[model samples]
Structure formats: C-alpha cells, structure tokens
Target chain A: MRGAVMHAPGDVRVEDRPMPTIVEPTDAIIRIAATCVCGSDLWPYRGLEPVAAPQPMGHEYVGVVTEIGEAVREIRVGDFVVGSFFSSDNTCEICLAGYQTHCVHRGPGAASGGQAQYTRVPLADGTLVATPGQPDADLVPSLLAASDVLGTGWFAAVAAEVGPGKTVAVVGDGAVGLLGVLAAKQLGAERIIAMSRHADRQALAREFGATDIVTERGDEGVARIKELTGGLGAHSVIEAVGTQESMMQAIRATRPGGHVGYVGVSHDVSLPGLELFFSGVHLHGGPAPVRRFLPDLIDRIWRREIDPGKVFDLVLPLEEAAAAYRAMDERRAIKVLLTV
Target chain B: MRGAVMHAPGDVRVEDRPMPTIVEPTDAIIRIAATCVCGSDLWPYRGLEPVAAPQPMGHEYVGVVTEIGEAVREIRVGDFVVGSFFSSDNTCEICLAGYQTHCVHRGPGAASGGQAQYTRVPLADGTLVATPGQPDADLVPSLLAASDVLGTGWFAAVAAEVGPGKTVAVVGDGAVGLLGVLAAKQLGAERIIAMSRHADRQALAREFGATDIVTERGDEGVARIKELTGGLGAHSVIEAVGTQESMMQAIRATRPGGHVGYVGVSHDVSLPGLELFFSGVHLHGGPAPVRRFLPDLIDRIWRREIDPGKVFDLVLPLEEAAAAYRAMDERRAIKVLLTV
Candidate 1:
C-alpha cells in the first residue's frame, strides 16, 4: 500500500508501505476512499511543531471496511463508513457523556495514515459510523468531512452556546472556521460575524451564512465585534485559530456571561488569570468529540441539508500527497482532498 | 467616624475619618453593624500585593440604612440590609444575565471602608437587599456573611453547576470555600469533598456539610480526588484560592465534562492554555457576581437555615484592627469580626 510519510519538517513523500493488519480484537481494516490534508498538519509541515521522527500523516478519512477482527460485532466488511479522529470504547462514562475523545479506553482511530490504500481502525464499532446505505459519489466529500471538520465546527458552535437570537463572531478563516459559520447558522444564531482578511475566504464565509465580516486582526478585530454588537461584544465567539493572538481576540470579543468555544488546539498561549477572571465569560473547548455527532451529521449530509464539502478547493491522487501538503502550507487551498 | 486604613504592608490603623455622605443620587449611607477581615485582605497585609497608598480596608458589610440620595427608592432609612461588594445598575443586560459584577453602569458598592462606623454604598437600590426585618443580636454576623462570603460561595457553586447527584470538590478552606460546601449541600450535591489540612478549618467544613476531607495539596490533592471518583474526577470543583497551584489542582480534579467555578481574586497567576484546553473541563468564574445571589443568601441567613457566621473565629473592637490584621496574617484566626 502507498502512504504519505514525513521524514522531517518540509519533507513529505508518498511511498510504498506495509499493509495494515488488525492487531486489536475490536479492530477493522478499511480500504480508503478519500482523505484530506488538515490545517493541523501544517503545524509540523511548516516546522512550527517538532517532528521527532518519520511518521505517517492524515487522520480524517472515509472508506469501505475490507476486513474485521472477530470481536468487532457491529461493523462488517464492504460497509462504507466515516470514522472520528479518535477511537473509544463508546460505553465509558466519558464517552456516554459525549466526550468520546476523552474515553477511558480510547485508541487512535487512525493507526495507519488514512492517506493510503488501507488503514486499521481500533474499536471499530465505536469509532466508525456506517453511511445510510452506500452514499452517492457526490456525497463522499461531505461524508468524509463529517469525520472531522464539520463535526468539529459543530462542536465549536455548541460549546459557544450559539442559539436563537445570539450574535456570534468567528475568529478564523480556515475550513473549520468557514464551516463554523454554517454550524452557527444551523444553530439559529441571529447574526454571524466572520473575521477574515482574505477576500476569497470572506466570500466563502458569507456563502456559509456569515452576516457580517471584519477584516481586522487582534485587538482591532475584537473592537469591530464589540462595535457591531452594541459595544457589549458577541453572545458567542468561536476561536478556530490556536495562536496566542487569536485566543485573546476570541476571549475579549465575548460579552460578560457569554461563551467562548475555542477549537484551535492551543500552542504557546498562556492565558492571564486576571483578565480571564474579570472577563466573566464561560470557556469550554478542546479536541472535538466528533464521534458523538457523526450519525446526525451523516444524516444531514445524506439529506443534502448542508453542503460542507465545498471547503475542499484542491483535489489530487494519493501519489500527489506532497503537492497537497504544499498547497495547504502555502495557503493556496482551504483544504486538499487526496483520493486513494 | 472611624475607619481602618492600611498605610503599608503590615500597618493597619483605626483612625478618625470624615463621615460618609450620599454623593450620587443612587447612593445610600449605612451605619455598619459589623464587618470582617476577609481571606483576600491577607494578600496585601502579608505583602503579597503592594499597598499602593493609605487605602481604606473592607468591602463587605451588613448595616442599618442611615440616609439615602433622592433617587434611592427601593431602600428606606433605618432598614437593615445586606450589600454586595460591587455596585451595579441592576437593569443593564449584563446584570440581567446574572453578572451584576460586570454591569455596564457598575460602581464600587463600598465607596467608604465598610469596616467603619458608617459607609457609602453606590447603586443602593441594586446593591443593597433589605432583610425581611431587623434581626436579633445573634443573627448580625451571619447576615454580614451573606453580604459577601456567602453570596460569593453561592455564586461559585452555581457557576460550577452543582446539582442533585453531583459530586463536589472544594479547593480552598477559607470562608468562601467553607460556604461553598454549604451552598453545594443546599443545591443537592450528593458528596462534598473539602480539601483542608487545618483541623479547625476541617471542623468548620464538616459543619458546613463536607462529606469527605482531603488534606493533600496540589498534585496529590488531584490524585486523591481522582481516587475518590473512580479515577474520573469530580462532577464539580469549586476553586476559592487564586494561586497557580490551587487553580491547576481545581482544574485537574474535575472530569472532562465537569465545571470549575473559581472566585478567589487572581494575583499573579497565568494558566497554561494547552493544559486547560486538553483538560476538557468547563471553566467559568471571576469576581463572582455576588449581588446576583445576595437576595437568596440573605433569606437563608434570616431564616436561620445556615450558620455561616461560625467562620468568624475572632472578634475584636474596630480600634484593634491592627491586631485583627496580624492575627489573620499569621493564620491565627479563620476570620476576624470588627464590631462597631
């Protein structure tokens, strides 16, 4: 099988790799249909994060089950499925409470890079959600999105408490942030403010239900949000960028007693205890529990109620994984789809 | 009139001061029945915080209304009342959202030292809640407690989402944390863990409805809490100490979906964003909109349903404030009541 491997920062190559076998009793092997380059991937590709050693890349995936371990009762071969980034027992107290990502018996859902011919999925029944029958070709990308970005954006909206009559501000322009606009609109937020300096991203943000746009960054961006919301700031703020500036902007852009749902994967950010204390805002976010919302999301995608797959702007064959990484790292693509 | 003023870190003196007057139309003057040295007071008294100038000391009080400005309508002269630390319009959107401490038209409720013969209270109609009636001599201290500590503790418990069948862990043994135990019990929490090493404080915690006790601090305390909760952590954790260690312990002791309600005044703490993000706990707190809980807290104290006044272990005349500060600074007293 061919897999994308990064030997060091700024180095990615598609090469032949060994076939993955089910090592866990509750595992299943899936033949990959499609996978994508995630914004998080850029952290290491750009050398912002340390690359300890050569490692496989890719977590978001959609595929058809090719084989199943004897203990895997729910998932069977030939069934098309979307899998969350993290696997869990699905019956732990944390998983039952909608925090499957923090389950007591959690496993890396994607043991082998999904940007390959085949991959091993642990806790198959708990990690993979079968599509309502085989999804149409046009629905593949959207279903693949349900495995990560769409579900993550949905969790951000839910954590922000975006609801009817709320004024929501989003602080990122990546695929996740654009999809957050869609989620906020779906959640009934009255006004959606997208803070983006890029024209193309702004257009997509608007198309995804952003009612307003502020092309400012940092303190200026927070000021724009406050000015737009009668000087009280937004009722909900979604932080999709993990940088220190974006985190501060998100926290400062929310009204007292409002919620700030941050999904940015914090990096080098130290929140001053004094300012956060005086802000009087609720803070809740971390790794998204995508598994919890996979079923509903798949249903919505199948019904064509949402078209989130548009986030992908570049598409290529699995052998062109290096080009996909380059396009994303250089901001030439919002997200790149790799067909396996 | 006489007031307590801190001229330096270890210097507190009770000296003659001009009588307070209602300066704003929303102001009221009150003849204090009693006031107490708070746990926060020790910060500056022990030089943890700089004594910028000869500032008046005290932000909590229960007293009889002496005079009122023309706009003060809801409260009457000679009525006994309990007041919050921060004054607010009580009509602003923030206040309506139960965040009165962050009110748009907020003012310092204790304009004059509350540990004085008489003090000025801003936004009288919003900050002062008249008790059902004048209470017997024995109820004075308890009613005073409701003005700040009890109200603060109640807000912390509310922020932590304490409810029926929830397990609560309190991370401070001060008056506010002790009262948090009481508030949790009143809110129907199933198990209350008080983290305190002092025997006297532990006894008070037990009296306030602590079901268990953990004497360990920092990581060990978090470990003990995890052991008690089947290694998943508690459902709700109340943080009443503002130190870095206490904050981290509180966050670590809460389960992934649990809440951390912090009310201690932050001094020099900075929370590492990565750990907080990965903790997956809901964090909500700040100066603790005590005014939001004042009415209910007063009712409970008035009905003799709780005895929060027991937190005050030392009683002294206003002239002995220096000794009172020293006692609290040296940990010789849990709290010291300053009788006018």
Candidate 2:
C-alpha cells in the first residue's frame, strides 16, 4: 500500500507502506475510497506543530470495509462508511452522552493512516456509520465531509445553539466555518453572518445561506457584528479559527446569554479569565464528536439534502497529497479531496 | 445617613453621608431593612481590587421602598423588595433574555451605598422584586441572601444545568458556594459534592443538602470528585472561587458534555484555550442576573421552602460595619449582615 508520510516539516511524500489488517476483535480493515488534507494537517506540515520521526498523514476518511474481526457486528465487509478523526466505542458513557471524542476507549484514526489504500479501524461498530447504501459517485465528497468537517461544522452550530430566531455569526472562513453557515441555516437560524475577506469564500458563504458578510478582522469585526445585531451582538457565534484574536472576536460578537461554539484547533491562545467571565456567553467545543452526527449527516447526504462536498473546491489523486497540503496551506483551496 | 466606606486596605469606616434621593425617573429610594457585606467587597477592602478615595461599600440589600420617582411603576412606597447588585431595566432585550446583569440600562447598586440607612436604586421597576407581604423578622436574613449570594448561587446552578440525576460539584465554600449546594439540591441534583476545607463551612454545606464533602483543594479536589464519580467527573460544577486554581479545578472536575457555571469575580485567572477546548465542557457564567430569579426566590422564601440566609453567620448594627468587614476578612465569619 502507498500512503503519505512526513519525515519533517513541509516534507510530505507518498511512499510504500505495509497494508493494514484487523488486529483487534473489534477492528475492521477499510480500503480507502476518499480522504482529505485538513487544516489541522497544516499545523505539523507548517512546523507549527512538532513532528517526531516519520509519521503517516490524514485522519479523515470515507471508505469501504474490506474485512472485519470476529467482534464487529454492526459494520460488515463491503459496506461504504464514514468515520471521524477519533475512533470511539460509541456506547461508552461519554459517547452515550454525545461526546464520542472523549470516549473511554477513544483512539486516533490516523494510527494506520486514512490517506492510504488500506487502513485498520478499531472499534469499527462504534466508529463507522454506514450510509443507507453505497452513495452515488457525485455524493462521495459530501460523504467524505461527514467524516470530519461537515459534522464538525454541524457540531459547532449545535454547540452554539443556533436555532430558529437566532442571529448567528461565524468567525473564520475555512471549510468548517463555511459549512457552519450551512449548518446554522439548516438548524433554522434566522440570520447568518459570515466573517470573511476573500471574495471567493464570501460568495460561497452567501451561497451557503449567509445573510451578511463582514470583511473586517479583530476588534473591528466584533464591532461590526455588534452594529449589525442592534448593538447586542449575535445570539450565537461559531469560532472556527483557534487564534487568540479570532477567539476574542467570537466571544465579543456574542451577546450576553448567547453561545460561542469554538471548533478550531487552538494554538497558544490564552483566554483572559476576566473577559470571558464578563462576556456572559456559553462556551462549548472541542474535537467535535463527529461520530455522534455521522448517521444523520450521512442520511442528509444520501438524501441530497445538503451539499457539504461543495467545501472541497480542489480534488487530486492520492499520490498528489503533497500538492493538496500545499494548496490548503497557501489558502488556495478551502478543502481538498483525494481519490484513492 | 451613615454608610460603610473603604478609605484604604484594612481601613473601613461607617461615616455620615448625605441621604440618598431618587435622582433618575426610574429610581427609587430604599430604606435599608437589611444589608450585608459580600465576598466581592473584600476584593477592594483587602486592596486586591483598587479602592480609590473612600469608596462606598456593599451591593446586597433587602429593603422597603420609601420613595419612587415618577417613572418608577412596579415598586411602591412601603413595599418590601429584594434587588440584586446590578440594577437593570428588565424590559431590555438582554434582560428579557434572562441576563439582566448585562442589561443596556444597567447600573451598579453600590453606587448609592447599599450598606447605608438609605440608598437609591436605579431602574426600580425592573431591579426590585416585591415580596408577597412584608417578610417576617426571621426571614430578613434569607431575603437579604436572595439579594445577592442566593441569587448568584441559583444562577450558577442553573448555568451548570443542575437537575434530576445530575452530580453537582461546588468549588467554593463561601456564602455563595454554600448557597449553590442548596440551589442544586432544590433543583433536584441527586448528588451534591461540596468542596470545602473548613469544618464549619462543611457542616453548613451538608446542612444545605451537600451529599459529599471533599476537604482537598485544587488538583486533589478534582481527583476526589472524579474518584467519587467513577473517574468520569461530575455532570455539573459550580465555580464560586475566582482563582486560577479553583477555575481549573472546576473545569477539570466536569465530565465531557457537562457544564461548568462560574460566578466568581475572576481577578488574575487566565484560562489556557487549548486545555479548555480539549475539556469539552460547557462554560457559562458572569455576574448573576439576580433580578431574573428574584420573583421565584422570593416566593420560595415566602413559602419557607428553603433557608438561604443561614449563610449569614454574623450580625451587626450599621455603625459596626467596620467590624463586620474585619470578621469576614479574618475568616471568622461566613457572611455578615448589617442592620440600620
């Protein structure tokens, strides 16, 4: 099998790797059908996140199960499925409480690497959610999105408590943030505001049901959101950029008693206790329990109810994983999908 | 009129002051029935919070409305009422959303020196909740507790989402934290863990329905809570101590998808964003919108269903407020009530 590996920062290479096999009674082997480079991947790729030794890349995947261990019951061989970055025994207490990302028996999906021809998945019955049927080829990207981004965006929206009568503001214009606008819309938000500077992303944001777009950054962005919401700030704010500035903007753009659902991978962000305490907003987010939303997201995609795949503006073969990483790092693509 | 004023750290004087009069159309003058020193007051009195020029101290008050401006509607002269630290116009959008503390027309109740014979309350119609009848002398302390500590504690419990079957951990043993245990119990929490080291405070906490008492502080306290909850942490945590240690313990003691309601007046605490993000806990808190819970609380007190006033362990005349402050500062009293 061939998979993308990074020996050092900015050194991504597709190299031969041993094929993965089910090693646990609850494990299953999946032949990768689709995978993608994530913004999180850029952290180590850009050297912002340290990389120790050569490591396989990619945690997002939509694939077809090729083999299953004895204990795997719900998921079977040959079924197309979507799974999250974190594999969990979804029946665990934490998972039962809708936070599979913190499941007692949780493990990273990148252990065997999803950006490969074949990968081993632990806790297959709980981690993977099968579509009603093998999805149409056109729906593949959207299904792939359910593995992480779309479900993450949905989690952000839900955590933000976006619902009917809510005015939602989204910080960060990445694929997750753009999809957050879609999620908020689907969740019945009365208005959606997308904070973006790029013309292309702004257009897509509008297409995704954004009622307003603000290009200002930092304090100005917060002030603009307040101005648009009658000086009270939005009812819900989704933060998809984990920088201190973005976090403050998201917190400041939410009204007292509002919600700030932040899903961005935070980096060196120290939230001032005084500011957050006085903000009077509910803060909830983490590695979104995407597995919790998989069944519903897969159903939505299967029914063609939402086109989450629109987030993937660039697509490449598995061997072009390096280019995909570059495109995302350079902001040339919101998301990039790789066909195996 | 005589009011308690902090001239400097460790310097409190009950000195003569001009009688308060309704200055705004929405204001009302309250004849102090009972008022008390608060934990927040210690911040400035101890010089942790700045005390510039003999600042009038105290914000918690339960009193009789003696005079009202033309615009004051809900409160009438001779009506016994309980109000919060912050006076808010209840009709504001923020107030209507149940965050009256952040109301657009909000003002500090301490501005007129609540620890005085007479004080002017702004937004009288919204800030004050009238009791069904004049509360008996025995209920005065409890009613005063409702003015701030009880209300704050109740808000913290509500923010923590304490309800039936929930395991609640309280991170402070002060008046507000003790009251939080009572609030959680009243809200139907099955198991209430009160974190306290003081035998007296612990006894009071148990009396207030605390099911368990953890004497350890900080990390050890969190570990004790987790151990008690099968290593999963509590479903709800109320943080009433505004220090880095207490804040972190509250966050760490809450399970993923659980809620942490923090009402402490945070001073030097800085929350690391990455750790908070990974905690997957819902955080919500601020100045308690006591006005939002005033009516319900008043009714409960009227029915004699819960006694929140037992937290006031010391009592003194208005002239001895200096001694009252000293007792609380020396940790000799949980709370001090001052009578006019």
Candidate 3:
C-alpha cells in the first residue's frame, strides 16, 4: 500500500508502505475510498510546526471496512463508513457527554493517518458510523466531509448556538468557515456574516448562505461586524482560523452575551483573560467532537439536504497526494480531495 | 454627605463628599443601610490594580430610596431596594436576554460608590429591585449580600449549569465562592466541592452546603478534584478567583463537555489559547449580570431560605471604613460589613 508521508517541510511523498492490519481486539482495517489535506497539515509543511521525524499525513477519511478484529461487533467487512479524526469508545462518561474527541481510551486517530490505501482503526465499534447502505459515488465526497470539516463546522454552529433570529459571524474563510455559514443557515440563523477578502471564497460564502461579507481584517473586521449588527456585535460567532488575530476578532465581534465557537487548531495564541472576562461571551471549543454529529450529518447528506462536498474545490488521485498538499498550501484550493 | 475614598493604596478614609442627587431622569438616590468590602477592593488597595487618583470605594449595598427623578417610574422614595454593582436599563436587548450587566443605557454603578451616605443609581427602574416591604434590621446584611456577592455567585452557578445530578467545584473560598457553594446547593447540585485552604473558610464552605472539601491549590488541587470524581472532573466549576492559576485550575478541573462559570475580576491573566482550546469546557464570565438575579435572590433572602450574610464576619460603623478595608485586605475577615 502506498501512503503519504512528510519527510520534512514541503516534502510530502507517496511511497510504498506495508498494508495496515487490525492490531487490537476492537480494531478494523479500512480500505480508503477518499481522504483529504487539511488546513492544520500546513503547519508542519510550512515548518511552523516541527516534524522532527517522518510522519504519516492525513486524518480525514470516508472508507469501507476491509477487515475487523474478532471483538469488533457493530462494524462489518465491506461496509461503507465515516469516522472522525479521533476514535472513541463512545461509552465513556466524556464520550457519553458528547465530547468523543477527548475520549480517554482511544486517543487521537489523527496520528494513524487516513490518507493511505488502507489504515487500521481502533475502537471500531465506537468510532465508525456506517451509512444506511453503500453510498453512491456522488455522495462519497460529502460523506468524506462528514469525517471532519463538515461535521466540524456543524459542531461550531451548534457550539455557537446558532438558531432562529440570531446573527452569526464567521471569522475564517476556509472550508470549515464556509461550511459553518451553511451550517448556521441550516440551523436557522437569521443572518450569517462571512469575513473574507477573497472573491472566490466570498462567492462561495454567499452561495452557502452568508448574508453579509466583510473584506477587512483585524479590528476593522470586528468594527464591520458591529456596524452590521447595529453596534451590538453578532449574537454568535464562529472562529475557524486558529491564529491570534482570528481568535481576537472572533471574541471582539460577539456581543457581550453572545457565544464564540472556535474550531481551528490554535497556534501561537494567548487570549488576554481580562478581555475575555469582560467580553461576557460564552467560549467553547477544541478539536471538534465530529463523531457526535456524524449520523445526522450523514443522513442530511444522504437526503441531499446539504452539499458540503462543494468545499473540496480540488480533487485528485491518491497518488498525487503531494500536489494536493501544495494546492492547499498555496491557497490554490479551499480543500483538496484525494480519491483512492 | 460622607463617603469612603481610597486616596492611595491602604489609605482609605471617610471624608465629606457631595450629596448624591438624581442627575438623570432614570436615576434614584438611595440612603445606604449597609455596604461591604469586597475581595476585589483589595486589588486597588494593594496597588495591584493602580489607583490613578483618589477613588470612591464601594459597590455593594442595600438601601432605602430617598429621592427619585420624575421619570423613575417603578421605584418610589420610601422603598427598600437592592441593586447590583452595575446599573442597567433592563429593557435593552442584552438585558432582555438576561445580561443586564452589559446593558447599553447605563454606566457601571461602581462609580457611584455605594459605600457612602447616599448614592445615585442610574436606570433605577431596571437596576433597583424593591423588597416586598422594609425588612427587619436582621435581614439588612443578607440583602446587602445580594447586592453583589450573592448575586454573582448565583450567576456563576447558573452559568455553570449547576442542577440535579451535577457535581460542582468552587475554585475560590472568598465570600463569592462560598456563596457559589450555596448557590449550587440551592440549584440542587448533587455534590459541591469547595477548594479552600483555611480551616475557617472550609467550615463556612461546609456550612454553605459543600459536600466535599479539598485544601489544595494549583495542579495538586485539580488532581484532587479528579481523584474525587473518579479520574474525570467536576461537571460544573465556579471560578471566583481571577488569577491565571485559578482560571486554569477551573478549566482543568471541569470534565470535557462540562462548564466553568468564572466571575472574578480577571487581572494580569493570560490564558494560553492552545490549552483553553483543547480543554473542551464551556467558559462564561464577566462582571455578573447581578441585576438579572436580584429579584429572585431578594425573595429568597426575604423568605429566610438562605443566610448569605454569615459571610460577613466583621461589622463596623461607616466611619470605620478604613478598618474594614484593612481587615479584608489582611485576610482577617472573610467579609466586612459597613453600617451607615
């Protein structure tokens, strides 16, 4: 099996590797159908996050179960399934409370790297959610999205408490942020504001149901949101970019009693406690517990109620994984899909 | 009129001040029966928070309305009232959403300094909640507690979603934290953990309905909380101390998907974004929307359902305001009550 591995900065390669096998009683081997590059992957690729050792490259996937350990009960071989970047027992108190990403037993599945011909998944019964049946080829991309970005955006919207008559502001124009707009719209937000300067992203944002677009960044961006919100700021704000500037913008753009749902992998950021305290907004974030929303999102995608697949602006063969990373790294794509 | 002023750190004095009058149509003047020294007062007194100039010194009080502007409709001159540290026009959208502390029309009532012979309250109809009748002298201290500390503690409990079957942990042992324990109990939390090092404070915590007590601080304290919760963390955490250490403890002590309600006046604190992002706990804070809880708190105190005034261990005449500040600053008193 050939898998993508990063030897060093800007040096992602598709190389022959041993096929993954079920190693634990609850494990399953998945034949990758689709996977993609993520914004977070750029951190190490750009040398901002050190890759001291060769590392396997992707964490999002939609696949078919190829084999399962004897103890794996719910998942069966040849079943189409979608799982989050983190695997969980789902029965633990934390998982039961809907924070499967922080499951004590399974740890983060990102390190297993899904952008491969085949990958082994532990805690299979709890991690993977099977589709009603084998999904059509067209629905594959959308299901793959539910494995991460789409589910993440949905979580952000839910965390921000987007609902009827609420104004939601999205701080990033990336795939997650754009999908957050779609999620907010679906969640019944009265107004969705997408802060983006890029014409392409702006157009997509509007198509995804953004009622307003602000081209400015930083303080200007917050001011614009306040201006649009009648000087009170948006009732809910989604932060999909994990930078100091984006976090501050997200916090500052929410009303005193609003909520800020952040999904970006924070890097080099420290929030001033005094400002956050005085902001009087609810803050909840972390790695998205995408597993919590997989079923509903899959159902929605299957019913054609949403088309989150559009976020994958560029699609390529799994063998061209390096190019996929480059496309997203240079901002040539919102998200890249690598079909196996 | 006479008022307490902090001319500099540790220099509180009772001096002649102009009589407070109704300057705004929505204002009402109250002749204070009781005021108290808050934990936050020590910040400026200790010079940790600079006192640029002589400043009026208190924000918690229960009083009788002595004068009302023509436009003050809901309150009358002879009414006994309880108000929060921040005045609010409860009709604003924020106020309507139950975040009156962030009301748009009125300024922070702290500037009016309730530790005086008379104080002008803005947005009188919204900020002042009249008691059913003039209370007996014995209830004065309890009503004054509702003016700030009790209301703030209640807000913390509400924000933390304390209720039946939930486990609540309090991070500060000051009057507010102790009252947070009381609030959690009143809110029907199944268990309350009070983190306090002092024996007296721990006793008070137990009296306030704390089911468990941990005399640890920092990481050790968090470890103890986890130990108590079977290696998980409390479902709800109240952070009544504003230091970075306490903030992080509050966050780390909460289970994933739990809530941390912090009301301490955050000072010189910066929360590492990565840690907070990964904590997976709901964070909500600020100067509490005390006005939102004033009515219910007043009713409860009036009915003798709770005795929050026990927190005030030292009582002094208004002229001994200097001693009250010193007693609180030196930790000689859990709280200081000043009678005018």
Evaluated with DockQ, which candidate comes out highest?
2
Judge candidate 1 at residue A250 and give its lDDT.
Answer: 96
Residue-level lDDT tens digits of model 2 in B1-340: 8988889998999999999877889999999989999999899888897877888888999889889999987789999988889989899899999999999988896558899998999989888988998889999999999999999999999999999999999999999999999999999999999999999999999999999999998888889999999999999999998999999999999999999999998889999999999999999999999999999998899899999999988999999998999999999999999988
DockQ of 1: 0.88
Q: What DockQ would you assign to candidate 3?
A: 0.92
Compute the interface RMSD for each candidate structure.
0.6, 0.6, 0.7
Which 10 successive residues of model 3 chain B have the least lDDT summed?
A: B105-114
For each candidate, report what fraction of the true interface contacts it reproduces: 0.89, 0.92, 0.93
lDDT of 1: 0.92
State how far residue B97 of model 1 sits from its true place (Å). 0.5
* Clash-forming residue pairs, model 3: none
By summed lDDT, which 10 consecutive residues of candidate 1 chain B come out lowest?
A: B293-302
| Model 1 misplaced regions, further than 4 Å | none
lDDT of 3 by residue, A99-128 (tens): 999898856563367889888888998899
Q: Report the C-alpha lDDT of model 2 over A1-340, residue by residue, as the tens digit.
A: 9999988999999999998877889998999899999989999999999999999989999889999999999998999988889989989789999999999899986459888888888999889988888878999999999899999999999999999999999999999999999999999999999999999999999998999999999999999999999999999999999999999999999999999999998899999999999989999999999998988888888888999999999999999999999999999999999999
How close is each model in CA RMSD to the real structure? 1.2, 0.7, 1.0
Worst 10 residues of 2 chain B by lDDT: B105-114
For model 3, residues B1-340, the per-residue Cα lDDT tens digits are 9999999999999999998877888899999999999998999899898899899989998889999999999999999999888889899899999999889875867446888988988889999999999999999999999999999999999999899999999999999999999999999999999999999999999999999999889999999999999899999999999999999999999998999999998998898989988889999988899998988999999999999999999999999999999899889999999999
Higher-DockQ candidate among 2 and 3? 2
Q: Chain A vs. true chain A, TM-score per candidate?
A: 0.99, 0.99, 0.98
Model 2 ranges with Cα > 4 A deviation: none
